[model samples]
Target: MAQVPLVVGLGVRNSIVSALLGKGSEKFNYLHRFLGRSIFVASTLHVAPYLHKYAIDDDFVAQLGKPVISTGCFGYIALILISLSSIPVIRRKAFQFFQISHWIGMVILLVSLSVHVPICLPFTLSSLSLYFLDLLLRLLFKTQNAFLGTPAVLLPLSDGLTTLLEIPSLTTGWRAGQHVYVRVFHPGMGLGKMWESHPFTIASAGAEGEGDGEPLRVFVKSVKRGWTERLFGFASDGEVGTGEDRMRFGGAKGGRRCRVLVEGPYGGTGNILFSSFSSVLLVSGGSGITFSLAQALSLQSKALLGLVRARSIDLVWIFQSEASLQAFMPYLLPLLNNASSNKTASSFKALKINLHIYITRPSSQFAYDPSLSTTLLPAHDHLYIHTGRPNLSDLVNAKVEEAAMEAKRLNGRGVNPCGLGIGACGPQGLVRSLRNVVGGLKGERMGEVGGVEVVTEAFGV
Candidate 1:
């Protein structure tokens, strides 16, 4: 009970525990709330008996004056505050306040408990030690210093709402679906941004060859305010002036460059062997495309080397408008173009790849241009783009049916059925819908497909 917070809080330093539990640190965040509630309940149970006994004897004042009783009372107050601040509504609406109060409340509770009961010192010490160790590990290994930070190029996508960051220097290998914390250093970003580190999923796959270097890429969407808005402003500042100056400052030759510290390669699909799946479906919404994009690219790279068993791969991406789809054309084009063009190995050519893009909103800035996509993308049979929201249930059912058919084919050939793998990363609503869709699948449908494994990626504090 005492160590629950330790497990819930530790991220990188608790990799062993995460691995043992078959989940990444971020994946188990729901448990943080649960553990917090359990702690508060247990604490109440322990303290209620003492309060009742003191009140019954009419010695409440005397007991309350004691060091242990007073400390315990203070700790309980802190616990109550912590629990209250952690409520979903409060936490979401006032995250900064919630975060600060949580930290302060934890310190008060832990210190009070240590003083209230000497026997609890070991638990308190252990928790503090592990918490600091994770911080130390993040500082020493995960984070690159601002002074030594690598230069990154920022390119605003066609949407005018998202920015693409590319860092060629930091070639550290990371698994697909993993994310990193980035702290930018730039003159225009202000002091507030200098100390802030935000998490973004790695958009590109890892290095394919031993000596080959792959640039780290991530897509950041700017909201109305905060760090991301400033970043977008800085990136687009060069284009503020009219005429030839804009051409000289903003295009491919003069994209904004900023030095940034990258800390991570954390929080990925844990214990899920992607290559083992015979059929794969990757889904993403808006900027969440980064996770699915990386997974698809990595699996394709692995398949080329005969390391993966997947025969077919499908990607379904839902975007707010055509602008977002156009923005991702550069990345999506290669995946579609290279499917059958790899000359080095014939086996790689045999991998069936399909891409589906759904644009839910009409283009707001300009009319949808069909030529931009058609000219860039080849006339591939498996590529599709739709105008409305996708039927998630139908899409999922189609994949399940494909997997079931593949399983029968494999069994007929006396080969083992490798099952289906579904990876989804998006808004909470989308994730919930997908989960319900998958969960609602009949048992026979599940069994016929060998087995369906679903892995989801999401981020929040």
Candidate 2:
């Protein structure tokens, strides 16, 4: 019974210790997420034997008085909190709650398990050490402002749907697809105020900024009841309507800027896509584009500078409306203009970047019948928006097959097998779908499609 918890303890370490494991040496591939179910099973096995013994003995109530029993109870309680909070429905509905529960549960498990089981003392120490290391590193690399960290100015759009943030003093050493945790304290910091922080991907290409103290830009959606809502609530007081009536909010207009704390640029270091990959596919949905845009630009820069292994780049972006596209133009324009530039090496003369956009719910004028598959007016560069949700499975499956065939053709020339890297960040369902598709494609055709490498961007942590 005591040993069962050992597995649960090890699994917990694997899940959260990545923050301490530096990215340059140990890039957390998120391979340990499956440990959630294993930890739950181990927790059940560890507790069931004790519960069975308790049921047969009338002294079970008296046994609760024992310090060991009471201490063990906390470990059980933490397990329950983690198990229930990890449910997909609960996790998706209230991510912040799940995050808090998991954190508290981990602390309880560490402290209580150490008191209950002497052997667990080392495990607790190790986890705590890693936790402190992560915090210390965050502070070391954290951007510094005049007073606090960074002064992030939030500019809410006319529609009140999106906000463009201009953040000063962004931390250095951030990779293309890395994200930062932001804690927004409206009207600057104050005592007794509850702080809510969320992880948002750095949207702009050089969001780390160049030289001394350039500003980093990112887009935040004004989701209802989301942390962003409270951060932008100051601007919501004035008149609210679509069109130019409201214009953009923040900076000069109304003058609202919030002080924020930024932590980490976790997951992969430097280049997101492994430098060895020949072809790269970037998939994004809605704000997930924040993860893809910077990566795409980095790949372009590498290809243009004659330092890239990837020749073909396919970017698949899905959105709800054209307004969303226009709102993101600030980040996307640089990539497009650079890719379409006339100057560059002959080898860099052509970058095979095929951009595909899928719009789920467009304007009233656009025809969309749910009964039909899709109503797409596919064009060259500016493809017409699609009417329905994307069939992600079919799309990825086809790409895998196509990449495999191309790799086989290149193998005859005595060249090494071409590698395909597929990276996606989006809604949970979409990210899960991409992961499923990638998992299903693994070990196909004698491992021939050169090699298919997949990286999923998840905000679950």
Candidate 3:
């Protein structure tokens, strides 16, 4: 009973289900938690009958000395400790302790189970095999060998910063919007010394840069907490943003470097959703633009090659300051430039690519920057910059109108256009608000074709 649920949950981890769900696998997280909770109940009942039958006699102590009996008792202790430590409150407060204890407890329990009922040894071995196989594969295949654990050059900005690693040798191409799990090692310790890894959207795509580029760029807002705070001390992409010793890094002063191991090209609308839709609206907040950029570029690539059905891509990004918008320009420029040069987006003659930039907090100097506008692309209009937070309800309503028009153009009799894939990756609050908007919009316009489907990746701080 215990192993059954665990196996079903852990088995084929990189199976078809994970491939389809991607980072959206959180939907199944509850199932794992529920199954885990049942282990305690099942073990308690199974042991009750044994205790009732044998307790309160000289023979009880003697009987427990047998290998099977003793092993079962020890395994029960292991299960109890693991269950207690796994509670949400305790786990959250002391994750490292919980993690260490969980693994140790699991090992003890599995070893005991193998001996308690020798016939079950195969099951224990199978469980351990799956766990180690997953770990080994993650280490061996997740990282690109050429860029496998390389030191990155960091640039801190007044707002956010970007990291540049030597992915110059990486050959595997990644779609935009997909992210990599990054593990940074201390300088001189080498990238192989990976202990902590965090997921970051690959801000730069493989195909859009000035030349063949590696998955070397990730724009990050250096908020003061955990990994983000430690990053500033290790390096910077521009002028160092924070920390007491904010020194300039350059060739003259041996460029500051932080080693990192890159893993994955995981999860994006382009991989599963965008290719099927004719019109897509990407709503983003702050660095969430990274998620949208990849899908847009990917959809464009496919459309140019007659691979996808998407013809219209609209990006609405919200940032705190104009500097952030400036900092993120590198990601946008290459993608747009690449599209302009690639057959002029000829798939849909009515194809209209919209880039809307909203700055929530403008600096005092914002009043002085002349010519805030820069030429973006040959076919489409340049960036449309707006002030303050966007009216998201209105934004979705407008998208709905576009969808209606698209349906009409398709020669349908009031048939809904293919539903729009509206994706976002940003702050949790932004996702919630967008979710509300999408939900209400969908409900209000039930019969509308080309429904608004939201795919959200909460870019946690």
TM-scores for candidates 1 onward, in order: 0.87, 0.74, 0.76
Model 2's TM-score against the true structure: 0.74
Using TM-score as the measure, which candidate wins? 1
Clashing pairs in 1: none
Candidate 2 lDDT trough over 10 residues, lowest sum:
245-254
| 343-438: candidate 2 lDDT, tens digit per residue | 454465545566666878788876634345321221235233466677887877777766766676677776776678888887877888888877
Top-down TM-score ranking: 1, 3, 2
Report residue 180 deviation for candidate 3 (angstroms): 2.3
Cα-based lDDT for every prediction = 0.77, 0.63, 0.64
Most accurate candidate by lDDT? 1
State the lDDT of candidate 1 residue by residue for 1-461, as single tens digits.
47544543643334556658656576766666667787888988998998889889999888888999999999999999998998989987676578778879888988897898888888888777777777887888777663588777776655777877888786656888888888877667877676677889998887856435358899888867767777777777644324463332223322477788888877778778778888899999888899888888777777777777887699999988776766677787777766777646555544557999888886655443444545545566778877789999999999998898899899999987878899989887888789889999998888887788899875455
The RMSD (Cα, Å) of candidate 2 is 6.3
Q: Tell me how far the alpha carbon of residue 65 in candidate 1 is from the true structure, in angstroms, after superposition.
A: 5.7
